[model samples]
Target: MTLPLEEDSRPPYLQAAEVLRTEILVGDLAPGSRLPSARLLQARFGVSSSTVQNALRVL
Candidate 1:
């Protein structure tokens, strides 16, 4: 069997963050509602905490 693939391949945390932020801007996510917790996104996108923080910093 092939070795396991490494994650963090494309900086998805940043990408995901941008997407979520845009969604909020376009009223997709909406405001006041609690944003997806880092753990949720980390699990969903297989991204690291720092990467997520970087993306949020942009928001």
Candidate 2:
């Protein structure tokens, strides 16, 4: 769940969303399971609170 953000043209939120989306698609995150807290995600991905929120919005 600790995925480092890659340095690229994509936005940080999009990158975070992509990781989460992959986890969901691959069954790493089962449906109906509660997602990690925003704070936890921020720490995991080294992103800000808003970035985490935006990522969740994408999902």
Candidate 3:
């Protein structure tokens, strides 16, 4: 089986930030709720910690 692979349309940091921000805006993820740690985001996004932080910085 061939699994589909795709490249990110936006920057990694931007994508990560938007995901969390959207969750916050939609109430899917509430404020003051413990967010996934940098390590977690790092693993999830497969990006560097700085990249995850850049996204969070947007919030």
Name the top TM-score candidate: 2
lDDT comparing candidate 3 with the true structure: 0.75
Residue runs of model 1 more than 4 Å from their true location after superposition: 1-13
Q: How many backbone clashes does candidate 3 have?
A: 0
Write out the backbone clash pairs for model 1. Answer: none
Residues 1-59 of candidate 1: C-alpha lDDT, one tens digit per residue: 11122543545555776677777999978689888887776666566777667777777
What TM-score do all the candidates reach, one by one? 0.64, 0.87, 0.74
TM for candidate 3 is 0.74
Q: TM-score of the candidate numbered 2?
A: 0.87
Segments of candidate 3 deviating more than 4 angstroms = 1-7
List model 2 lDDT by residue over 1-59, tens digit each: 54444556688898899998998999999999999899999998988899999999998
Better of 1 and 2 by TM-score: 2
- Total backbone collisions for each predicted model: 0, 0, 0
Across 1-59, the per-residue lDDT of candidate 3 in tens digits comes to 11111555677777777777887899988877988898887887777889878888987
Error of 1 at 1 (Å): 25
* Rank by lDDT (best first): 2, 3, 1
lDDT of 2: 0.87
